[model samples]
Structures are given as structure tokens and as C-alpha cells.
Target: MLWRAGLTAALVCAIGLLPWLAHTDPALTVLKARSAERTPAPETLRAIRDQLGLGDGPLHLLAQWLGGLLHGDAGRSWVSDTEVLPAVAQALGASLLLMAGAVVVAVLTATAVCARTLRLGARRRLGARGPGGTGSAVLAALPEFLVASVLASVIGVQLEWLPALGWYGPQWMILPALALGLPAGAVLGRMLDDLLPAAFAEPWALAAAARGVPPKSVARQALRRCVPGLLPNLGLFVVGLTGGSVAVEQIFDIPGLGRLTLRASLAQDLPVLQSGTLALVALAALVALLARLGVRRLIGPALRDGALHSLHRPTPPAPRVVSLVYLLLLAAVIAFGLPRDPLALDTTARLQTPSAAHPFGTDALGRDVLARIAHGALTTLGTALAVSAAALLTGVLLGLLPRLSGPLVDTVNAVPPMLAALLVTGIAGSGPWTPALAVAVVAWSPLATHTASLLRQERATLHLTATRALGAGPWYLLRHELLPAVLPPVVRHALLRLPGIALSLAALGFLGLGAQPPSPEWGLLLAENQPYVERAPWAVLAPAAALALLGALAVTAAGGARLPRRRRTPTPPPAKPGPAQPPATPGQPHPARPVALTTPTDTA
Candidate 1:
């Protein structure tokens, strides 16, 4: 395991080096002047070389990176003349302060939502989709951007309790972190929400609960039972949170790696950009590694073997419930999309003389805002689904492959999703497809790792082995053995990611790198109307509301959809035995005709 982790780290580091390596050529672009700063003067270099036993070549890179690792000496900053160590150190400190609070906010809120969702039995009313697991659906649809805008408007703009656009004291981190963490946390909650129910339904849980244990106790026990399955996800979750740092830090300006990356991009400082990107990747890797180790330690031995066989048992059947769910989804898409004029009648419209002829009323563009909103819903939801589906497929393929733990997987995993995304977009040049593709590409790896890890872990279970032993081919194994075992969690995770993807895409759009003008993306809309926040507010609110509604729907769908309970059939009792005696009864019966043996009839 240590070796696995070390390999993972090395792979991560190597992947993290790609951007830096792109700049390693001396003749490349305009960083020639900045390269000199990375190393000391010749005399100082020689002195340091002598002190460190450097024979130059590629050896120095290792020495430098190693030294940087231990003492935080990450070479030099490109834009700021400050030492990379101190500059990032200060920035990281502030980032951590914010992240700590953000993580807490994310965990608590997500856990609360997950708990409520898991307990909600029916999913219809929970989301905007008209009940029945709609909460997660709504959450997923709303995205973090929507949440951010809403909070920023309600709490920051209207109430004026907090500044709408500035990052100030610790209190400022609250809303920003909530914005950043809520969606992610809700996504995390989905992982728990799916697995926890299965745990509760386990034979062990039943045994525990049959003794009159409280539901809360059953849930904890369920949590305990689900530990091994949840461990890998926990690692992935923490790391992904680290990845999200870019947007959050930028929003709050806490000087973290995220902000640095943004600064790097804006200045086109290759070195800064590379360093900042790699720093985030490394941080994410470290967080995941730590979480992985922690989970392993906590899983321990006794429980490990015990848990191995439980979930490994042959899957009962696919819940027709999910099929019902798909039908419901189809119905929703139609209803939401089909409505060309659902809101025709309005007294407000009649009074204002904005009649049915206008229907959705006129936007500042004189186009129908309602039509645009509906179309925008389809566009946004469609984009989200496309991106999410692509990500999910990519993540599953990469993650499920045993090779995921290898060099390539490690490397891919090591590359921060955001950086990878930017790299792809930068290379692909400008287009809506580029961003969408970039979003898909960036989103795939983490999801893949997550999927693969779950499958790999599940691979060790007795049920998997048993199915294999029963002459199941690899395809059969995948269909009969693997798919059923892993699908639920994957579905949950995908649902969770739905909102994040939308939010990230919108954020990219907001930054002017997403969809081009007139695309009507929520983020672009926000950017379009950002100047009007103090005035009309509707322009900003309209799109922000759309993004929120979408994220909220996705989240509620993912986190709130409980795995349907498997009905247990009653066990039949064994037949009862006839009572009493008879060894002597045989002889007595022989004598019965002669008067009941010894004591009978008058044996007297």
C-alpha cells in the first residue's frame, strides 16, 4: 500500500511537471529573462552545487524539487519578485484558513442534506422536478455559481451585511466558502447517501437493528459497515475540493494556489502559471494521499476481512425503481422543454398591458425572455448532461482500468483537473466546443479514479470471486459481477458532479473564456449583467436563478435518491419432531395386546 501510494505520488509529480516542462526549453517564448532568476549567480550556484553535490544535468531538477518539497523552496516567482517560498507560504496560509472553514461548511451542509435525503423515503417532492428525490436533482442543477450569486445577492447585496464583491475578514469566507463547498459537499453527500442505505440493509445491520437499536445507531453502524467503500471516495473528495480552490480562491482573493493560478493566467507568466498549476496538483495529491492513508488505518484488519464478503454477495437485481426514475427524468425533460407557453395568463401582465402576445415579456433585447429562459434551460441542462456524461464515461474507463494505479493513470490523476482543462482549452484554441470538451476532459479523470477505485476495491470481495468461480467470463463478470456492484455509487457520484460541472463551465464562461457572446450561459449572463447588480439586478438575477435551479435539481437527484430497500423474504421453520418415548414402547406395544407391557392393564 505504501508502495502504491508512493507510485501514485511519483506519477502525480511527473504529470504535474508537464506545464513546467513545456517551458523548460531555453529558446521558448518570452520567459528567458525569468529563467535566470530560478537559479542563483554562477558563484552562488557553484557554492550551492558544492554544498549540495550537484553534478548538473537532470539531477538538479530532482535536487531542487526535493529541496522544495522539504523546505518549501519552490524556486522563484515570475511576476512577484518575492521568493516563491514566502510568497506561496503566505498565500497558502490564508488559503488554508479559508479552506478549513470552507471544508467545514461543505461537510456539515452536505451531510445535513444527505441525512435529510436518506431519511426522505420518497424522492418526488425533494427537488424542482416535482417530488421524489428532487432535492438532489435540484441541488445538482443549481451549481455553485447559482448558489454564489443567490447568496451574494440576498446576503451581500440586499441585506448589505456582507460585501457583494470583496473578500474581507473571516466572515467574508463564510458566504464564499458556502458557495464553493455547498455543491461539492452535496455531491459528497450522494456517495454517502447511496452507500449508507445499502449498509443499513445489510444482514449485520438487520441483526443490529432487530435488537431494538435506534435508527441513528443503525445509521452509524451502517456508516461503519460502509467504511471501506467510502474510504476511497473520501480521498477523492478531499482532493477534488483542493482542485476547486481556483474558483473559490479567486472569488475570495485569499492568495491561495487557486488565486495564484488565476494571476498566472492573466499575466501569461508561463513559469508562474506552471508553478501555480503544479502546486495545486501537488496539494490535491497530498490531500488524497493523506485521506487514503487515514482510511486504510481506520479500516483495520478485523473489519476489513469481514466487510470483504458482505458486499461481495450476488446482487439481487436492478431496482426497477431506477428505470422508473429514468422514465421520470424523460417526463421531466419533456414537461420542462415542451412548455412553449405555460405561463400565458398573468394579472400582472394584463395590468401592465404586457399581454399574451408578448407571453414571456420582453427582455432588454426585445426578445422573449421566457422563451430564452426555457431554451436556456435546455441549453444549460443539455450542456451539463453532455459534459457530465462524457466525464462519467471517461472517469469510469480510466478509473476502472487496473492501469489506473499505474504511470499513466497516476500522471493523469496528478494533473489537476482545472489545469488539464486549461491546457486542453489553450491548445484547442477558442470555441464553445473547446470549453465543453475541456470540461469533459478535465472532469473525466477524477471520476474515473473514483469509479476504478470502487470497482478495484469491490474486486476483492467474495461475491466478485464467487461469480468468477461460477464460470463467468470477463464480459459476464463485468455485467453480472462488476456492473451491479459499482453502478449505484457511480450514478450517485455522477449526479453530484452534474452541478459542479455546470458551475465550473459557467465560471469559465464568466471569466470570458467560456461560450462566446449571445450564448446565454448563466455565467456569461452574470458577466453581461454584472454592472447592473446595483440597479436593475434582474439581469444578473435571471441567469443566476437559472444556474441555481439547475444545480439544486441535480444535487437533490443525486444525494437524495436513496437505494430502494430489498424486501427480505421470511424464513420457513423446520418440521417439529414427535414427542416421547418408544424404545420400550415397541416392546410395550407387543405386549399391549397382552395388556400393555409391564405396568399396563393390570400388570396389576
Candidate 2:
């Protein structure tokens, strides 16, 4: 665990070195010098001097790295030629403030939602919170900007309650934080909603509660048992707080990192661009690493138990209760659209014709306005669902197999997913698949790393030893044993991955490196309507709206994203007149593991 955390810090430090490396590279210097009509020799020399701290010596690199860590500065902006420290510093505070604000909101909101599990007679209540609720879903579906916009428009603009711009001041932070925090809170809420109940089933938690603990005490105990998964998301929610800040920043004109990002994007300022991008990447990497570290920490005790005395517990069965919600969602789509496009997207569809048949009116293309918009929903929703599920599956496979080959796992872990995504996308035609595939490939390593780590933690349990003794083959153990034990956390990890999945897809689509014309993806829609931003702002607004909707749905479904871990055990025939307490060892801890014991028929 300590080693993994150290590795995480080291990698972050390495990533911090990239911008400096790029600036100093001879070829890049030559290209830059040529562009500026200067001699590459002097520029290259100067660049080298700068990066190596040649004049500054080790102290310079040390200064920059340390400053970046403590203060976020890597020298002056290579493009802007200003103190990089100030820019980094300025961006840092805003981003952190907004992130911190969101974290507080999400934590508070989710805590309240998860707290419902502790109420009296709450067992009859489900952990599934608001996945099916339209309000949270809609609020979630609304883009951060839109949410902020509406808030500002009503509260800030008309009502004159709060300032609309700036990430500074308590007043400024209010709307942006709400905008960023609420959506994430919704997601986190959904994730823990059902999970809290499941945690209620954990042995230690129930044991604690069975001791006549208060309801709140029981809830807290159950929550602790589930920390193995929840802790990782603490890192993930930070991303949403950071990534989703762009819109809120713009709406409020906050001087935060997201605002800087907006400027960097529009100006095409490479240094600011690179630096801004680097900041985002670094933040994401840090979050991901934090998640990994948290998982490792969680497994420490489990590892100790496994190593000291194997559990040798029986394997449990996989839950057959699949979420039919997807299929039901399909039905909902159909039901929502009576003789309308089931997919709900109308790029060219017009508005407000208001006929009995064409109630929503026709689009610019004269298509069924209602049907076209409806069909459009398919493109965004289907793509999100399919791609997210795919990336998740890929990551899960990669994360769970460290025991298969330790060196291989290390090798995979060493390379960052961002780079992997860049390489694959760079090689394979930098289209939508490039990033999507990149996400699947790159994002997978962490999950794979964590999955394997968690499973390893449980390998020494008596149950595992007993299974081995029962002649259980590796395949059987994997299916029935390891999988169920870690299934809840694995599900949690997948939930955490959904946001990244959506972000990657949206990013690809946004970059014009994704779905092409006529695809109507929210990202592509942004591009298609870029020309109309001034005249028909709805074009941009609509696609942005789509992104928010799809993002919200995914995050919502992920709330109770788990399948049943334990099912009711059938009643055994009435015991004979013998003792009620049976021997602790079941079946004498079979000497030979079953060939297929990876899978089991019951939970511990």
C-alpha cells in the first residue's frame, strides 16, 4: 500500500516535468525558433538552461517541482512569457476553491441521502435514491452552465441576490459551487443510496449493529465497511468538481481555472493551453492515484487477515438479478414518444408548429420536429451507454488480473492512461473511437490495478485456503470466490469510472476528433451549431443540454449500480433433536478445492 502511494506521487512528479521537457526539446525549440525567425541554437540552449536549471541548477527544477506541488508553478508561461508561477498560482486557487466547495456540497448532500438508510424501519425503504426521480435527474441532466445560467438569471440577474461572475468572494462561489456540487452530489447520492443497504448486510457492520447499537451507529458502522469502494470516489468526485466548473465559471465570469481554460481554448494560447490542459490532466491523474491509494489502504487489514489465516469460506453465487432498467428505459423511451422518434434528437427540426400530429413543430429541415428530436436522443444516450459499458468492462478485466502476472501489471500501471489514449488515438486515426478506445485502454489500468490489489488482499483468507483444499481450480475460484467477495467494490469502481467515460467521449466529440457530421452527438452538435452561436444559440444550447442529460442519466443509474451480493438461503430441513450450534468448520474444510469453486452457491 505504501509502495503504491509512493508510486503515485512519483508518477505525478514525472507528469509535472512534461511541459518543461516539451519546451526544452531541441526539435521543438528549432520549430519554435523557425516560427519566430530566430536561431534554434540560442533558443535551444536557453531552453535547456531553463529546464535542467543549468544556470538555476538542480535547485531550479527542484524549485519548480516543489513550487508546483505546493504552489503549482513550472516557470513562466512558455507562450505568454509571463511568470508561470503566477498563472499556475492564480488558476490553482480558483480551481481548488471551486473544487473544495463542490466537495463539501456533494459530501453533505450525499451524506444526507445515504443517511436515510438509518431511519427507523428503514429496511423497507430501498437504498436506490433518485435514479428514477425526474427532478434530480433533470437537475443532473442540466449542464453546469445552464444550471448556473438559470440560477444567475433568476437569482443573480433578476432578483439581484448574488453576483454573476468571479470565483472569488463568498457570493461568487455560491452559484458555481451549487452548479458543480449539485450534479456530483446527485451522482454520489445515487451510488451510495442502495449501497448503504447492501453495507447493512456486511458481517462486521451487522455484528456491530446487533450489539444494540443506535441506528446512527449502525449506519456509521455499515458505512465504514463500504469505505473500500467509497474512498476511491473521493478522488473521482474531485474531477467532477473540477471538470464541471467550466460552465459555472463562464456564467459567473469567475476568475477560476475553468475560466482560464475558456480563455486558453478561445485564444489558442499554446502555453496557457498546454499548462491548462496539463493542470487538468495532473488533477485527474492525482485523483485517480488517490483512489488507488485509498483502495490499497482499505485492503491493508484484509491483507493481514488473509496472510495470517485463510478464511476458506465457501464461494457465493453471482446475482442473477440483472438491471432490467435498460430494457425498461427502452420502453420508457417508446412510451414517452407516442408516434414520435424514439431516440429524441432533431438537429434540423424546427420548433413550435403545434399541430395535433406535430405538436412540438417541425425543424429547419422540415422533419417531424418531435420525432427528429426524439431520435436524436438515441445517438447521445446509446453512444454514452454503450461506450461507457465497454470502457468499464475493459478496465475491470485489466484491473482484476494482477495475480495473473505481477510484472505485466506493473508495466501496464507505469504508463498513464492519458498517454496510452494519446498514443492509440494518435495511431489509430484520431476519431471518436480514438478517445473512446483511449479511455477504455488507459482508464482500464487503474481499475485493473485496484481490482487485483483488492483481490490479493483477500487471497490469504481461510475461505480461500479451504477452497484451494477443496480442489477448486483457478477458474472456479475466480468466478465463485474472488468475484463475489470483491463484487461490491468492483461495482463501486465502475460507478466511479462512468464520469470519466462520459468526459472522454464528450471530449473526443468536442474536439472534432469524434463523431462526424449528421451524428448529432452532443459534442458534434456543438460543432455543427458553432456557426450559429450568435444567431441560433439554441443549437449550441441544445447539444450542451443533451450532454448534461446523458451525463445525468448515467450518473443516476450508477447510484444503485450494484447487483445483489447475497440471496436468501433456503430453509434447511428441521434439525434433529441435536444441538443447535454446529461445528464452525463446514464440510471439514475440503482437502481438495473443487475445479470450479471460483463460483459458489451462497454468500458467507
Give the candidate number with the greatest lDDT. 1
For candidate 2, the lDDT comes to 0.53
Give the per-residue lDDT digits (tens) of candidate 1, residues 167-259.
667677788778766766665565655555444444445454445555665555555555555655555555445445665555444566656
Against the true structure, whose TM-score is highest? 1
* RMSD in order of candidates: 11.9, 9.5
When summed lDDT is taken over every stretch of 10 residues in candidate 2, the lowest stretch is 595-604
Q: What clash count does candidate 1 reach?
A: 44
TM-score for each of the candidates? 0.70, 0.64
lDDT of 2 by residue, 1-604 (tens): 4444454444444334433433334334424533567556766757644653446533355455555646555555444557655685587678788788878887776765555555631342443231133234444454454556667766876788888766457778877778788867765665555345554544444444445556666655455444554555556457545643655666677666655654543332334544555566557666666766775555555555453222122223322232244435434543554465434455654443447765444434444433444455565555656765665576567557554423333433334333444345435656546656665654554455556555665575667888888899999898877776665555554654453455456555564555654553444444444444444445455445445444444444444434455566898999778666554476564333222211011112
Off by over 4 Å in 1: 1-75, 117-132, 160-169, 300-368, 375-383, 402-418, 468-475, 506-514, 548-604
